[model samples]
Target chain A: MSDEGIDEGSRRDGATELLPPHVSADFYLWLWWKSEEENGKFAIDDGRGGVEVYIDDRIALRSTGEERPSAVLTGESPATTPEARAAVAGGKVPRDIRLYVRRDDRDYHVTLRGTRVSIAQAKLPAQVKSGDVAEVLYDRMFLYEELHWIVACLLRAFAAVRVTAAWREDLVPRMARWATLDEARAGG
Target chain B: MGILKGALSVRRYRVIGEVPEGFRDLWIDTLNSHQFREPQSSTHKGEVVGWAQAHNLLDTDFTDLNQWLYDRYAYFALRVDKKAVPAKLLRAHLQKRLEAWCKANNRPKAPAAVREELKETLEMELLQKCLPRVQTWEVLWNVNDGWAVFTNDAELPNERFQKLFLRTFGLRAVPWSPLDELTGTEGLAEAVAAAGTTDLRGRGA
Candidate 1:
């Protein structure tokens, strides 16, 4: 948790804190792409271990300009729907998504909003049922900390790859192909 | 509800500004000073907000740091109490008073100023009789990491929290968004700032 090497961006003193929220939206879209393309598997070098991400039951698509701009799809594997893929092809990015993430043996189901990357209704992995009161409290806190760490790592992985030219040149094209092919298959 | 048990919904913020020397004592003193207290009878304010223990909202005493400060994390709750008088009841009471005054004065109708005064009086009386609604949100702050997790994501509560945090800790807290984290990196600032929505359908943007 030492921010020693991490550079502070808009966080510098006297700098404006306002930041474009589109990055988070893009991250969500990227996460969706990775989840399907990479088969929900990602590795990190920080030593905490790799993460497996699964698209859950809910996904929200947002358009920057339109009369009707946002769509929320729910039920089992909403991300697999033609409408979901069509929405993306129609120039909509994911503004919110539900993901089931597994790190080590722990599992977390969380709904993430793109604007501030807010986590909602997060279901953490079960804890040991029998332990001392203090131990139980500590266990709960450890799980909470682990959840934040995994999420931060996920974002970090995305940010690391997103800033590269490959994101626009290579990654986006593949993502585009995936969206269109699936959309066409679904008769979108 | 998020801190101890139940589903978690939280907003995260990074504490800004330098941590002055003796921050431990400073935080303890600030937390104690800002402890939850009932509103005085004289003030027209119906709502009051302050800090409380995360374990028990009713407990505002933070004299023992061990109760809340665990390892590198500090745990607490934001307690808000609001007194609300039912509008219909207040209107009914005001009407009764206004009619009585008009009848005594031999006036056909109550004057606007008199009616306003009667309404205020009735409202005060009703507020006194009404119980204040109590609610609490848990906050888990990682002092070492300089970030905090607030249980509630609603606009008003988060605003209140930021204001209270600045007043108590003498620091500003900015929401830690994905952009912020990415832009914090050395070379990624410009790239992240320039990022926009991408069309993923093999379609032209």
Candidate 2:
């Protein structure tokens, strides 16, 4: 609730990185690789079946069991958006990441863009049923907690994971062939 | 604004598992098979989940003619309503009933049988006054490309939806975990395997 990740008395389910930290190139790279492997059907961990990642396939053809929608990105699909695809191929990492966390019935939706998260809801309990606003406050609290856990899980898995040096070396040449931009080339 | 708008928050799930050809027809059959059990006034029947548009499930299940076109979406909802006597109010009423029953039966704190009878009487009286609190969760399934955007994130709702989805479609909606959960890196298992004999563990072994 305080920030990303679930706070137990101690060990939480997500990454323990600082808030507002820019997502690293490695995370995207790893995600792309994983997407290629799974064919774009994967969910976010500890998401309790809440948050999921749907990959757009243009480059990686093995990610689906069927020949449907995997080849071409949909109009509004972020998976294979030009910028995102480019970034995954050899473009710079996205400026920021956006995650949408929601409860199925509650009136509010939380938008977490980068370090800032804002909840937008029209039916405030205070406006609808004016007594104690604890339910409303608690709803907000639950929303924040869920988002923090998702962000933490994502950032931690990527940032804190210790991949072998051999993998980095192997990734470089493959990346060099794909990337066009200097930042991507050097970063990869 | 609500579960149905452009500017709303939702956990996006890639619809895993094969949704067979003629999925609409299959879906209608599934919806009818798993229609929700209506809430009753007797017990603490907490919630129920099923088709948002039961009528559609009965017919062609078409929200728009565009469903026959591109970008088709289906609506589903989880409704939670309870009809239970308020515990505190029931307890107080029970106490009064118990006192009156004890006086009528000429016992200090009525025997177990008398207490049970009085409690049942009070329950019948109080059940009539109980009001069910209603909650509904709506979600959209982009049936074409296989995307399920759930509007709520509560554990109960999510769990119910998972069960409901399986019952309705015979498909698994696993909470999609990212790369780590899927492949399980365990500190780059692929890289270490590729490293072969020269790897660190190789020397130790």
Candidate 3:
């Protein structure tokens, strides 16, 4: 799959930019919009066979395999939505795009494409907080959950061994420590 | 330590001496048998072996030897002298040790917002509440002198338990019990028959 979106020249004046249309005949592209409360938009242009657009990982639109290039915009409006405008202005241009292409008869290929635009120039709403720590917390909690499972599995295995009392005793505290760490990390 | 390996190696070290003959079959031939067929080199098995060797419960050779025995016997349970240390206590201790190690590693703590989100996301409170239930199941299995017990109670003997044993321990069904290989028989008749000597009709019916 090939993605040719706006280049540095397009960012100079916010002018009518031309993104090099992606060309693929046998795959579907999905656009995901993650926001507090607004639907997102996505468009695709298939040069030969028509393209399919998926929203929230589900098929929202499917072209009739027409040779004419086509695009599907997700959400209610692609160009005039408040969320989209804010996203574009923040230079965080919806790069949450995924491409799926088909190969041969039995194989399918998937790829992630799209560029991020900086919205530093856009004025921010006074109500919106700049340093939102939720993202950071989410990431840390995810890591902790993963680590907790690992430690629990290890401890359970240790118990199954029916080993020496001394060694088992020695390792018990260690395993517990790991569990505690996992809980702490998970923000338990 | 040496005693532990010897116990594990013994074809059958009685957990409760004078257990019904069929009970042995149920434990070793059935439940224990299923435990051995679990995925190879699973973290649980590895940890068990590692702990055994580390604690001198078994010699270095004991690891390979025990594994080989598991391959041949299908399932083997060591009769640990509970007077020394109960398996539950041992497990709890090991968990504590691992927690300590995690602390020493000095990984960053989860941020408060993340903690709250994760607690909600992973249902941390629910998991914590469930931990006691899980521990209860472990205790039930450890104490019971009859057939090995499992956590999920709603699961019938022949289907879910057997499948779970196989998955958890990597042991295969020994084809000794008629229900061991039986399929499409999920009703009480099949369950009673799988129970071997349980007279479902005589006592209850």
Candidate 4:
């Protein structure tokens, strides 16, 4: 690995300019693999009892082709559906996903965009509604920062494994196996 | 402010370029120089974009550093006040004026010069009577991290904010993209450049 493509990748237009090759899509796929593999439990090293993540009802998958055809799934655990696995078998990667994260006895809902790896429309864990303006502002900022920390840790965890040879020699094969197993179960 | 309440929506940008030492006093001056002014008092129309106090939009005063600087972060709001005259209303008023001009000047229709003047007059009058629509986007800049969080997702406003940021601080605000995030990690630079998107279709499927 060299710095040859770093500048070139950044120079590309649209979402491609923001990510190395397919890293964003692969990152989401890797998350999905982890979710199912470890029953949605992730020890992100946040000091407290780690976070639990689950892919919610909404998901969008895009194929690796010139046209880049995409399938958007919504309603009741779409991530575990047969079509989702079938799409993966057809080389479709996760584009956008609704995620449910729980940590420290609190729950959060957010949308993760694979194209830029941004967390949008985040509904954070509830805190006491304070009367003081400064208190409320500080509380809000703290919650937002905590959410950002959790997300950053998740990406860091993924990057640690993703940059390794095991991702190519082991992880991808396991994920492919999982997708194929689901496809067979669905008779697709 | 969106940052203080409601569902969180933030777009982070890494502030490129360095700020000189003693930026506190410098930035306070810079912020005051770019502070919001009354559109009605000035000859400006359409919309006026400027920095406003984070706690209060009406308070354009930024003399006190304690008002905005909290710990290692700077907080402010980008205020845009827009005043627009409705097209239909302007058209109707212009038509009446045209008729009035024709009758007064003893002609079938008013001349082009007169019509232009009438339209401009009507627009200014309508603009004056109409109250401006004010919209503010909260900006929280982590001075230590060199990243700023703008509590907005709109395209046009974000573009305006970026331009204003560069003009005020003499720095470029690049969107904090995923690759940009990864590049900050110690051992990921080469790995990021080398990694390509994997297609799992052929591996086992």
Instruction: Pick the winner on TM-score between candidates 1 and 2.
Output: 1
- Kindly report, for each predicted structure in the order presented, the TM-score of its chain A compared with the true chain A: 0.81, 0.45, 0.18, 0.82
Say which candidate scores most in DockQ. 4
lDDT of 2: 0.44
Cα misplacement distance, residue A54 of candidate 4 (Å)? 1.2
**Which of 1 and 4 is ahead in TM-score?**
1
lDDT of 4 by residue, B82-180 (tens): 888889999999999999989988999788899999999888888778878899988988787787888876667777787788778887666775445
lDDT of 4 at B99: 96
lDDT of all the models against the reference?
0.76, 0.44, 0.25, 0.77
- Please provide, for model 2 over B67-100, each residue's C-alpha lDDT reduced to its tens digit, 9 standing for 90 to 100: 3222365655555555677789989998988888
Q: Give the clash count for model 4.
A: 0
| Candidate 4 lDDT, A1-188, residue by residue in tens | 12211222222333335355477777788888789888999988767768999998798888764324379999999988888887988778888888888887778887877566676788877685656655666677777777777777787788888878998898888899888774345556
DockQ: the better of candidates 2 and 3: 2
lDDT of 3 by residue, A1-188 (tens): 11122223312211112111111110111122211112321121222332222222211222333323233345434423343333322222233233222212211112222211111111111222233333322332233222222222322222223233533354333323322233234556
Q: Model 3 over residues B74-167: C-alpha lDDT tens digits?
A: 2222211111223465456545544554477674454456444543433333333332211111111222322232222221322333334344
| Residues forming the 10-long window of minimal summed lDDT in candidate 3 chain A | A116-125
iRMS value of model 3? 32.0
lDDT score, candidate 4, position A36: 81
Kept native contacts, fraction for each prediction: 0.39, 0.01, 0.00, 0.45
